[model samples]
Target: MALATSRFLPVLDCPDPRGLAAFYRDLLGWQVTQDSDDWVELSRDGYLALAFQLAPQFVPRAWPAEGVHSHIDVFVDDLDDAEREALRLGALRVDHPPTPQKFRVYRDPAGHHFCLCTT
Candidate 1:
């Protein structure tokens, strides 16, 4: 018999799981389904949650060098409005004057790179 393995969640490393989780929770419009001092999960009604794990010795990835191991792309109708909201939520702009592709890159409070785009 095959073992049942049907769930997948991307876990990000951060010094403070609580704060990073809060950032993703707000960014994804998801609610926290689970919480702990060292771990957190943000989930939507029918989607797998994005999880965070505490890593006291975590180092920020070197973008455009080591590049991103993984990055999230959030599609939005109003790129400006979305970029504004991301900035308000502690995301710092990494790439300005987005390309014709209509995507803006940003680094979250914990320094994780993600994109606000129109796709």
Candidate 2:
């Protein structure tokens, strides 16, 4: 049994929702399904969505730090090309040691950590 049944919508908190949303919109090529001053939603299909919510005092979690909640993993075909695109979109590469061969980590403009994974 499940308490609720629905598709997952990942929401990221950032200082500027629109700016963050634009970053992801360009990265994923998703359409802006909804928009507001403090929130924005992007979707490729109605079944799944990604959203950004304004958090004026948001403090981003540090990579390689404990007690972190979650991070996004974007799978792609080419690691080098994906890394290039993410960097072009204002993502800063996280260069900690012991990086896995199949994935590379990066931080978005708002400072949230995400991975460019190959699988």
Q: Which has the greatest TM-score?
A: 2
Pairs of colliding residues, candidate 1: none
Worst lDDT 10-window in candidate 2: 60-69
Candidate 1 local lDDT, residue 91: 94
Candidate 2 local accuracy as lDDT? 0.88
| Alpha carbon deviation, residue 47, candidate 1 (Å) | 2.2
Candidate no. 1 TM-score: 0.90
Report the number of the highest-lDDT candidate: 2
Model 1 alpha-carbon miss at residue 73, Å: 0.8
